[model samples]
Target: MAQRGGPAPFPDNPFQDPAAVQPRPGPELDAYNPFESSAPPYQVPSAAPPPLPAAGMPPPQAAAQPPRKASPTEPRNYGSYGTQVPGREKAARPPQGGPRRRREPQGLAFPPQASAAAATAELLKRQEELNRKAEELDRRERELQNAALGGTATRLNNWPPLPSFCPVKPCFYQDIPVEIPADFQKTVSTMYYLWMASTIALFLNFLSSLAWFCVEPSSGSGFGLSILWALLYTPCSFVCWYRPMYKAFRSDSSFNFFVFFFVFFAQNVMYVLQAIGIPNWGFSGWILSLIALRKNTAVAVMMILVSLCFTAVAVLGIIMLKRIHSLYRRTGASFQKAQEEFAAGVFSNQAVRTAAANAAAGAATNAFRAP
Candidate 1:
């Protein structure tokens, strides 16, 4: 069997074993292997030594050190990397420094001269506006003055230096009459009546005194005393009745008329006191009559009687004045309506036109300079 198996099929190939198939052990496994070299551990080459100095000169000095490399974990910048081309690798440049240049503004440009011209135009426009205002004010003042002089009822004329008529219509009197309203006229009439009544009462009181003097001649009264009383009553009566009436007639101002009436009404009361022979009554009568009455009683009584009659006439006059005032009041209202109509007709349109013109001018000026 040995001889037959001896032809032992060719020795089993050791190469077919898994463990023997591995690389053979050699210097490759040694700690130091000069002959076995790998791709050279990826080492970065050291910088080439500086060029040797000329023949006998000292070695070249080193340049200042560049900044150290960043760690692998740090951000890597490819900004300096160049694209791969045939054979070129352009060196990267350091970032530039210093202040950035400013870009010039574009679009519509106004020269310095244009700006100055615009300013001058604005100043001129302002001056024109002020001048216009001044003229307007002056015109208004003139209008007011003319109105006052011609009376409030006067129509306003747009053209200057032309005479204007009162806008109020003519009343009972053909001449321009004070244009008081109906209500105001009634008030004036009432005031006049009151004042006249006071005067009449004073006059009647004087008549009573005269009758008394006639009955008793030895009553120690005199003409001088009566005359003195009459004088005092006359002026007070004027203040009480006439002055207020006159004021109403002249101005037709309700406020002024009322003021005069109240003041005079007070004075009338004082006259009544004096007429009744109250002691220390009037300044002139008491002082002057006291001295004169010492001689003649009859004459004094006569004078007193005449004053009484005068007072009665004043009463009648009050009634008459009231009637006349009532008539005037009705006429005054008509006048006022006419005056208002005339004013509207004359000035309203002119004022509107002036305002419109000014506004249009302003709008035109703004449009010319639209942004």
Candidate 2:
């Protein structure tokens, strides 16, 4: 071989061993060898390894490597991967257009309808409870009512009886004390009857006058005078006698009775004037008397007669009422005296009666002992 332009070649030695043909220790020995040196030592290029396997596939050019051991902090993923447990597989879903499946709750579940039914049942139960309470209350009320209506004989017997206080004083009636005197009723009746009779008589008298007027219109102021008389008598009768008599009979007041008598008498005078056809007198009577007479001729006349009769009745009624009132006044005073005596702790008739009964009982006991 031809030598290259470089350091001189070493001499071949027959005595040297083949292994000993290596370079000796020197700076020249540390120099780079041509066969070993393709490039600068500091600047050599390295060949890259083959690409990794695609997901779910084997590597294209290299044999698969043993999987690296997982660090404690690293999670292991396995399946196509090696030597590691696989993550939970997602449940495989059916493709679209497949029949839908119902999903059930993993835990206890209540349907809306079931919940509503439960609420409704609870409400019904509550209503039933309330109804039961109401029924119990009603039963109690009825029981109380029955008790009050004398469920026990003793209770019935002990209850206070109703008081009777009618002026009629019917037989078999309970006697409740009244403010009016006992005689008031009788007096009022008597006076009322008398006044009634008087009123009838007065009415007849007025009618007679009307008849007289019909027979001789010229003798009086004609229909006008008759009408006037009717007007006067009618209202006067009511004002003087009827109304007052009613009051007297109803109330038995002496003052009312007195007033009734006074007004009735005055009315009588007016009626008399109307009957006689006294021009100025009848007019004045009509004007002065507080009679509410109607304007119609026939009605007025009738009313007048009726009023007159009522007036007479009222007068009699007044008298009776006065008597009644007087009796009542005396009775009231006596009652007041009795009340005062009772309040003062004085022995009343009732107390005396009681004392007498007690004394008689004592005496009887003494007599029996002596025997």
- The top-ranked prediction according to lDDT is 1
Residue-level error in angstroms, candidate 2, position 91: 99
Q: Once model 1 is optimally superposed onto the true structure by TM-score, how far is the C-alpha of residue 53 displaced, in angstroms?
A: 99
Pairs in clash, predicted candidate 2: 191-317, 195-312, 195-313, 196-313, 199-309, 200-309, 235-291, 235-292, 236-291
Local distance difference test scores for all models: 0.53, 0.51
Best-matching candidate per TM-score: 1
What tens digits encode model 2's per-residue C-alpha lDDT throughout 1-371?
A: 65788655554674575557765688876785645634333435469865676799955655685644544445656553343357754556798998998998787788899999999999999999999999977755664566567563322221123345633332221111121235444553454456446545544545544544554454354334545645565545555665555554444444455566677557555544543333323231232222323334553455455445545444555455466446546634344453454455435467777998899999999999995
The residue pairs in collision within model 1 are 153-167, 200-311, 203-308, 203-311, 207-308, 221-297, 222-300, 223-300
| Candidate 2 global lDDT | 0.51
Where is model 1 more than 4 Å wrong at Cα?
1-179, 218-224, 239-241, 245-262, 271-371
TM-score of each: 0.26, 0.25
The sequence of per-residue lDDT tens digits that candidate 1 reaches over residues 152-209 is 4554323123334745432222111123344556555555555555455445445544
CA error at residue 38 for candidate 2, angstroms: 99
